[model samples]
Target chain A: GIQVEQSPPDLILQEGANSTLRCNFSDSVNNLQWFHQNPWGQLINLFYIPSGTKQNGRLSATTVATERYSLLYISSSQTTDSGVYFCAVESRNSGNTPLVFGKGTRLSVIA
Target chain B: GAGVSQSPRYKVAKRGQDVALRCDPISGHVSLFWYQQALGQGPEFLTYFQNEAQLDKSGLPSDRFFAERPEGSVSTLKIQRTQQEDSAVYLCASSRRQGNTEAFFGQGTRLTVV
Candidate 1:
């Protein structure tokens, strides 16, 4: 079993500000995804970056697989961004494995 | 369906009662998974199905919890003699493939065992 640790268990930011969340894994992973769980509890897919960088609107993520760390960036944050952000991954050597999730970082953006 | 669909968004069960949760994955998706999320925690895997065959179920917390996907498109998770600790949000997700693919999740079913 691999370990996934998310930083800043809780975060609060003013609207229009920027923030970065980090996730560190214990081993090599073939699948890495960032998700935003809204107030209604829907897990919205943010990015599927096992490596490299990807940007989606005010959200972006980068995963440095070699170092076993990933970063999620939210810019010009809005109140709607308030929720929990999760990072999940599966080991590269584990065949057809389910993604293991981090404890998640709760983000709150206030106007 | 455009996405995974879970039935009975919320359920309240008395202790010792049996309950079943249903998941309808996106049509043609090959991999279906069940996860349990406790309050203030991330989702934990319960079982996984690659088509009609269940390849992994090591995450199941107890023998009382069972899941099956007979035809491979829809799956059901059954919990027998539920206890208070069984209260959690059950999430269902599906991926296009069994490996190296992104998973789409349903809204989830919140179960409260009293």
Candidate 2:
């Protein structure tokens, strides 16, 4: 089993500010993804990065598989972005594997 | 469907009762997963299914927890003799591929065992 750890357990940012969230995994992974759990408890998919960089609107993510880490960047933060951001990874295994998620970084964007 | 859909968004059950949670993945999805998330905690894997087959269930916390996807389109997670510890948010996800792919998650069902 692979372990995932997220940094900055809590974060508060002003509207329009930028922030970076980090996720470190213990073992090599087949793929990784970023998710946002909204205030209503809905899990929203953010990004799916296995070993590269991807950008979606104001949010972007980069995964360095060899080093076993992934970073999620949020620019021009909005109050709507206030929620828990999670990093989940699928361990490289022969069988169908599930994503193991980190505790997550709770982000609060104040307008 | 537009995305993964879970039924009975919230449920409350007695300590010794049985509870069943249902999840409907997106159409054409080949992989489905079930996970549990305690308050303020990340989601933990519970089971995985590929089509109608229950491929991996090693993450199930105990034997009392069981899941089924007989038709491979819908899934149901049943907790027998529920305990307080069984109270949590149950999440379901689906992906088009089997090994490596992005999984779309449902809103989740919040269960409370009193």
Candidate 3:
């Protein structure tokens, strides 16, 4: 089984500030996704970047597959962005298996 | 029709009771998954189904936990003789394909076994 590690276990940012969350995996992965779990317990998909980079609004993510690491960037953070950010991965050995998630980065953006 | 939907957003069960959680995946989606998340913890895989056949269930913690997807559309997870440790959020997610696709998650069912 692959181990997923997320950095900055907790983060507090002022509105409009920028922050970077990182995820490191112990093994190669075929699928990688970033998710945001809101206060109400809704898990929203942010990015599905197995490799390369992707941008969605003020949020962007980059995955360096070779290095087994990924980064999520949030710019001009808003109060609505406050939540637990999870990074999950599917390894080559676990075909068609469910993803393994990291503990997550808890972000709190104060207005 | 729009996305994965789970029933009974919250449930409280007496210890030793049986509970069933339902999940309706997006129409036409082929892969469905069940996960458990404890308070302040990330979601952990529980089981997976591809259509009507369960391809993987190695994540299930005990034999008391079982899941099924008949007709390949809707799925149900049943926990028998639930214990306090079963208190957690049960999340259901579905993807269009079985491999290399983004999964859409349901809001999840928060279960508390007292």
Query: Candidate 1 chain B — worst ten consecutive residues by lDDT sum?
Result: B95-104
Q: Which candidate is the best by DockQ?
A: 1
Full-model lDDT for every candidate: 0.96, 0.94, 0.95
Q: Per-residue CA lDDT of candidate 2, range A23-83, in tens? A: 9999889989999999989999999899999999999999999999999999999999999
| Order of models, best DockQ first | 1, 2, 3
State how far residue A26 of model 3 sits from its true place (Å). Answer: 1.5
TM-score of every candidate relative to the true structure: 0.99, 0.97, 0.98
DockQ scores of the candidates: 0.92, 0.88, 0.86
Which of 1 and 3 is the better model by TM-score? 1
On lDDT, who's better, 1 or 2?
Answer: 1
Q: Residues B1-114, candidate 1: write the lDDT tens digits.
A: 999999989999999999999999999999999999999999999999999999999999999999999998999999999999999999999999987899999999999999
lDDT of 1 at A16: 97
Off-target runs (Cα >4 Å) in candidate 3 are none
For residue A2, model 1's alpha carbon misses the true position, in angstroms, by 0.8
Which residue pairs in model 3 clash with each other?
A: none
What's candidate 2's i-RMS value? 0.8
